[model samples]
Target: MTTQEVANRYIELEKQGRWDLIQEELYSDDIVSIEPDSAAAMGMAKTVKGIDAVKAKGKAFNEGVEEMHGGYCTEPIVGGNFFSVAMGMDVTMKGAGRMKMDEICVFEVKDGKIVKEEFFF
Candidate 1:
């Protein structure tokens, strides 16, 4: 798939809250996920290699979220083999209380599969 096609599929699955399916279908086995430098303070690694590790990171976050008040995912902006989305969520964390989290999610695609995803706040 081209970047635009991947972006569209990502948006569609995200709207359906099916990120797990997206990962399974659209990501490469060696996909990498990167968090901002400051995320280390939150117990997230600066970079995670492999699709399984990426899913584990997401699972950890989900486990820590007590409730989700709201969330939004913007239409993707396609650029060559890359795409970006502006996403945010309001949520209550297990021990951190309620917080509004906003960030830009950028994805890189190659050979019709997502190879990398990086988050910036």
Candidate 2:
């Protein structure tokens, strides 16, 4: 798949909240995930390497949420092998109270798989 194809499929799965499927189908084995430094305060690593670790990180995040009120993922803007999307969510965390968070997520595609993803809030 081309980067545009990957981006479209990502948006499709994202709209359905099918994160597991997105990762399973689109991520490269050696994928890298990067979070902002401030994420460390929320018990998230600044960087995660490998698809397994990334999946674990996503699982941990989902586990931390007490309730998901709503969320949105914007259509991706593709350029070269990179695509970017704006995503936001309103959720209640296990220990933290309900809050709304928004972020810009950028993904790099190579060989029809997402090789890197970085988030900025």
Candidate 3:
């Protein structure tokens, strides 16, 4: 699949709350996720290898969000085996209140599977 296809697939999976879909479709057997600095997760970029780890991370993210809305794809900058997804994510929390964070999510695809993923928010 093309970079646009890869990017679009992620957006779709996220919207549908299918972390498993992202694991099976976009990610390879081993995947690494680089969390953002401002993110609640520790480490700016931690390599969470394998599908289970990725899924756990996804669940954790979902649980953290008190109310999440206003998600969109602003722009997709595609390249060979990679796509830079510019997005807007509105997250409301019990304590922090509502905020919209512009993010750049990068996917590393090999043979149509995302081997590594990272986000800068």
Candidate 4:
């Protein structure tokens, strides 16, 4: 698959609420995930390495969400080996209450697999 193909499929699965499947299928084993400095204050690691680590992050995040009101990953803008999407969500956390979250997520793909994902809010 090409970079665009992978990105499009990612958006498709994301819209279907199938993020778990995306990481398993589209991400490289050594993929790196980067969270902003502010996220560390919320208990999220600033940098997460490996696919398993990424999955763990997702699990931890899900465990913190009491309810998901709604969420979305917008269409990606592809360029060379990268693509970017605007994503956001409205959710109530276990103890953090309800809040709206928004960010731009940029992904770097190589050999048809996503290798890095960085977020900017």
Candidate 5:
């Protein structure tokens, strides 16, 4: 799959809310995930390396959520091996109150798999 193909599939799965499938199918084994520095206060590392670590991070995040009200992922804009999308979610956290979180996510694809992902809020 080309970068465009991967981006399209990502958007498709994102719309379906199949995040597990997205990681399982589209992420490279050595994928790297980067979060903003402020995420450290939320108990998230600034950078997570490898697919397993990334999966664990996602699992932890989902576990921390009390309730999910809604979420959205905009259409991806692909350039070279990179694609970006604006994503947002409205959710209630376990300890924190309900909030709306919005971020721009950029993904880098190599060999038809996502090699890296970085988020900015």
Candidate 6:
């Protein structure tokens, strides 16, 4: 699949609360995900290395996101095997109501699976 397609699939998996969907289909064993600093996640963005680490990151995000409303993607661009996207999330942050967070994600797909994921805010 194309890079934009890979990135969109990740969003879809998270929306469905199907983190397993990503692990089983899209991820690389050495996947690395960079998480940005936000109210829910404090400190500078950090990278989670390996498949296990990536799953932990997803759970960490889920801990903060009690509910998801709706969202969209824009500026989806691809170069080489990497797809980058600018996305916004309309989410309920745990006890907080709705909040919007702008994020940029770069996904590297190899052999039809995502080998890397890096995000920024």
User: Residue pairs in steric clash, candidate 6?
Assistant: none
lDDT of each: 0.95, 0.97, 0.75, 0.95, 0.97, 0.76
Candidate 4 residue-wise lDDT at 109: 96
Residue 121: error of model 1 in Å? 0.9
What digit string (tens of lDDT, one per residue) describes model 5 on residues 1-121? 9999999999999888899999999999999999999999999999999999999999999999999999889999999999999999999999899999999999999999999999998
lDDT: the better of candidates 3 and 4: 4
Candidate no. 1 TM-score: 0.98
Q: What does candidate 2's lDDT look like per residue over 1-121, in tens digits?
A: 9999999999999988899999999999999999999999998999999999999999899899999999898999999999999999999999899999999999999999999999999
- Give the better candidate number (4 or 5) by lDDT: 5
Instruction: Report the Cα lDDT for residue 4, model 2.
Output: 100
Backbone clashes, each candidate: 0, 0, 1, 0, 0, 0
Q: In model 6, which range of ten residues has the least summed lDDT?
A: 36-45
Off by over 4 Å in 1: none
Can you give the TM-score per candidate against the true fold? 0.98, 0.99, 0.78, 0.98, 0.99, 0.72
**Model 6 clashes, total count:** 0
Error of 3 at 81 (Å): 1.6
Model 6 segments more than 4 A misplaced: 1-19, 37-45, 95-97
Candidate 1: RMSD to truth: 0.6
Where model 5 places Cα greater than 4 Å from the true spot, the runs are none
- Candidate 4, residues 1-87, lDDT tens digits: the string is 798999999988998999889998999999999999999989999999999999999999999999999988889999999999999
Candidate 1 yields a Cα-based lDDT of 0.95
Off by over 4 Å in 4: none
